[model samples]
Target: MNDLRSWRVPLPQTAVKCAATVVLAALAVLSTGDPQLVFLAGIAALGAGALALRDLLAPVRLTADAEGLTVVSGYAGKRRVPWPDVTAVRVDERQRLLMRTRLLEIETRDDLHLLSTFDLGEDVRDVEAELLRLSARD
Candidate 1:
């Protein structure tokens, strides 16, 4: 049974693009004739813009199989967590499942390893029940 789906964060790209544009514009105005400072600020702004763009484009996927759990997101890239290594899994404040493969959320907060939320909204209770049942078995 392959459950494939996707969820999106709100206005990820728009906000990023707007902020980047504003920063670049500001840098341009303040730059005057200082090439070095302008260059550095421009680079920083571009980097932030790139990160935001990445988040906007990245896909978060959750897949289960005979092997185990897999989370695919642009930030964390692709990761597979064997069932044994999974300590706990729960939906986070952002609605993404938080998977603990090791030392809790200390490592990453990106939902790269997220399971798909495609049809979860319509069957939340059933899904929770299923998760509880599976967790108990483990």
Candidate 2:
């Protein structure tokens, strides 16, 4: 449990998907001369390109260290949480449609942050264990 100290998690899959969306939309815009279709495709391409840039750029989705954690706020900015402010970090497991899903839950006084494997790029149990170890030292 004490082998780790910090972590930076990024959503690579999402970035790849966004990049693909941008490419496909750009192609659609180029292929169609219809004003309405071109306009829609151009908008879609721009939005996906923005999202792709965000995902590919340096500010990763989640970062953790001995002092605290920081998460990118969808496109707004980064949100930092000190260790003292963290109330709990656990795996929230649920069953739906005959499938089991697990998410990492980080709770604070005012907010509950839930992260999936797609978000963390790591198993929730592993993340929970590392987080517990970090918090235990504090």
TM-scores, all candidates, are 0.43, 0.71
Residue-wise lDDT of candidate 1 within 12-48, one digit each (tens)? 4447565885788589669979988788877877777
Candidate 1 lDDT at 35 equals 88
TM accuracy, model 2: 0.71
Model 2 ranges with Cα > 4 A deviation: 1-15, 33-47, 74-76
Report lDDT (Cα) of residue 24, candidate 1.
Answer: 80
Q: RMSD to native for every prediction?
A: 8.3, 3.5
lDDT, residue 72, candidate 2: 63
